[model samples]
Target: MRTAKRPLQSQASEAQKQAALRYILDAWEEALHDGIEPEMLANAALFAALADLIDLYGEDAVAKMTTGLSRRIHHGEFTLRRTAQ
Candidate 1:
């Protein structure tokens, strides 16, 4: 009997995603070690980092900061990306 294949998003169990994310993140870390400032990181990594930070700092502080940030965004107090920079 032929078995079905899973989509890449859910394929290779956990190892594939972990390996790709680890490779990308290690490049960022190596850049920092080499005194280079990365202009951007993947959104997935950012979300993970935020979750890790919240775990480290607890909910209250991170929540307060995000709430304030949202308030600033609502008030037009922060810069946003443009269509063309």
Candidate 2:
């Protein structure tokens, strides 16, 4: 019998999201330790590091990270969010 796959958002919670964000930050720190370029860090390098973390940590972790990013966006913590007038 086959089981249905749960969507990432459905599987993630606030705490899990925070943990994933922490993991991403840690990965960024590690990349800095290896002397990755700043511009690269802002682009593909950051994503690469995040992908490595997700590979090591699992899909759930990535989903949580996505959730955390979304929360930040919703709260206007991310630059893309619009400020209240």
Candidate 3:
């Protein structure tokens, strides 16, 4: 029974994550339509994300997690556009 429950729980967790992302993206789009500059929005988004993560997981843990972000960014993990090299 425990093993069976794990799949259901994982699916629910994934669904929740998707829903949360949609909500955040919708709010971000609305903010942009309301005249918020993209750079300002990006800064505020990073601050909010880091602050909430630190609050939930502590400063040291969040700092460690963020240390990999530079490598991820360089690898284009967050890139929306790709062109032929």
Scanning candidate 2 in windows of ten residues, the lowest lDDT window is 1-10
Instruction: Please give, for residues 42-79, the per-residue lDDT of candidate 3 as tens digits.
Output: 99999998777666566666666788999999999888
Model 3 lDDT at residue 66: 81
Q: How far is 79's C-alpha from truth in model 2 (Å)? A: 6.1
lDDT tens readout by residue for model 2, 1-85: 2222333344578899889878877987899899997588788855776676566556666656666776786676756335687
Clashes by residue pair, model 2: none
Name the candidate that leads on TM-score. 3
Ranking according to lDDT, highest score first = 3, 2, 1
lDDT of every model, 2 decimals: 0.60, 0.67, 0.74
Model 1: lowest-lDDT 10 consecutive positions: 1-10
TM-score list, all predictions: 0.34, 0.44, 0.75
Put down candidate 1 lDDT per residue, 1-85, tens digits, no spaces.
Answer: 2222322123455888779767876887887788765554445566886676566555565555576776787776644344564
By the TM-score metric, which is better: model 1 or model 2? 2
Instruction: Provide the lDDT at 27 for model 3.
Output: 91
The TM-score obtained by model 3 is: 0.75
TM-score of 2: 0.44
